[model samples]
Target: MANNPCIIIADDHPLFRSALCGTLQRELNEPQLIEAADFNSLQTAVEAHKTANLILLDLHMPGAEGFSALVFLTAHYAHIPVMVVSAMEEPDIIRRAMDHGACGFLPKSASIEDMTAALTAALAGNLWLPAGIDDTPAANEAELNIAESLARLTPQQFRVAAMVNQGLLNKQIAYELNVTEATIKAHMTEIFRKLGVHSRTQAVLAMAQLAINPNSTLEAFRSQALPLQ
Candidate 1:
């Protein structure tokens, strides 16, 4: 069908990807599925097919690390909705995915029926979470403020910031992005201003604060939420 929707399935596991593709073929009406085994390929596919309807992203794919791909995509491609399809079923991980702007979280262990339902919900412009899981906002005010600051970064600034977080020098990032070191420096200046961080160390720490410690933060907040009359 020429009018069919386009979807990207980005997971490193071959069998898992095949299974997801098969499930989508059965559920969706002649969908155009693009498969990616790593974050680099995922980026290429998204760039090539700008009209993609949904992205099924695995959290641990090569080049993605943890939530780096999610953060980058959500920051850059806010128009395309993302649904995290990861084996990481930890509540904190799911919560963090949603907080980072995923429209849905589907565990790899989910049945075909459940997968179909979640995909449908996401395509219908609704948020989906595992059954019985609360969709409460996961991050506290301080953490959300950091996320908002990160979201404020332009696409190029976000890429440069991610490379910086990976300990890449300006020259290295410049070479990777095919731009001059001077351009990278200019982007860094804007990045620091948007993030309110004076130096690279502070900016990396700010991103880390948002990406790390969800479980501990949730536990602490839950403890505090307990009532004592």
Candidate 2:
């Protein structure tokens, strides 16, 4: 096979964007790649090249409008495939993107093997999913609690939580969410308080529990809590 495939990666964090590029460099042979740091940059990059084989999209870029960007891509470039790459392993977001024409989803915690598999599958016209999902819908009560919990958050806090769930560092989340790192720090404090948890891992776990079961309650989470670190 020729190195004819091209990829575009849209993310606000320069370091992560660069890291993704490196991943591609390691995994792909002579792959053509483009980088964008924001929504406008992504839009510009896409307009500049309509023939890209894949778009490695990050939904929570600063001012990127998340799913709205996915909609735009489907409307304008219906033929192109989009692989949502983010720390957001939230099943709802994953399912919703698939409903809207995304070709695949890659969680940030995805292993290198996972990335390679997803990319290869997407390139071969297959819709890819993480291991263990296995034909079952990712939903549940805990996911519902997360939804309710998020619904109760201020827009700023919600954005922060979303980024955190996506596995971004506070500084990176700050950049993508368009606030200072200090602001993100403050928001984390508030988010922990609101979610009744003290850490990002706990919040993500809570969301995962909720996603698998919408009826998930905080009490249920308490029973299964990891010992305090």
Candidate 3:
């Protein structure tokens, strides 16, 4: 109910974003809205609008690998609250989003009333969960600990680690980030140190711990670990 609260809608879907914008404008008092279609752009928007009141992030965006973007934002932009807005509303994913630092989880299918309530709670600095979901943030677990470590990474280092988790080589990461390979190597060293893992494979495993589908990351890592025939 804060007057003219600035909100960033960080989802890739244009129609849905527009509709959500309309809903907020109608329900709230002159809410200022910003749109970001991808994770990278969300970061840019956050940087440009550091005073933003809230960010409605998509579960999957171009530069977001699982809940990594959530972790990065909560870590780097600790002041602004992030309420994840996504179509994937599985209970576990919603809980994990909160555990990883999301203020709320608003399913894309949420009714206008539900969206308004969730936004109100989040803006008031409270946690919000969808109907039938437990309001509590997830309990302490191995992934939470790993999230703590990943939270320590600088923005650039987080990007490097995310790229590494996707199996990108140092040179490839450097090219994508428009930096030199040696600079990337230095980043890798820091990322490993921060994550408490020395090798890229170990870093990958560490990062995988934060994936939305817990089983899939472990399974994929296991398949990679199997001996070649």
Q: Rate the local accuracy (lDDT) of all candidates.
A: 0.81, 0.72, 0.84
Better candidate number, 1 or 2, judged by TM-score: 1
lDDT (C-alpha) at residue 13 in model 1: 94
User: Which residues of candidate 1, in runs, are more than 4 Å off?
Assistant: 1-3, 61-65, 212-229
User: What are the TM-scores, per candidate, against the unseen true structure?
Assistant: 0.82, 0.58, 0.90
To one decimal, what is the Cα RMSD in angstroms of model 3 from the true structure?
Answer: 2.5
Tell me the tens digit of each residue's lDDT in model 2 across 146-169: 444554566457656766655689
Model 1 scores a C-alpha lDDT of: 0.81
Candidate 2 off by > 4 Å: 134-229
Model 3 Cα lDDT, one tens digit per residue, 1-229: 7899999988888998898898988999999898999876887888889999999988777666778888899999999999988889888788888888889899988888898899999999998888899856653477888889989998889888877777788899999999999999999889888888878877777777777776797797788673322
Q: How many clashing pairs in candidate 3?
A: 0
User: Per-residue lDDT tens digits of candidate 1, residues 1-229?
Assistant: 3336799999999998998888888888889999999766888888998879999999876754367678778887888999999877978778888988999999999988898889888887789999977776666676677778877877667678878867689999999999999999999999999989888766766666555464564465446553321
Candidates 1 and 3 compared by TM-score, better number: 3
Superposition error at 224 for model 1 (Å): 32
Score candidate 1 by TM-score against the native: 0.82
- Displacement of the residue 111 alpha carbon in candidate 2, Å: 0.7
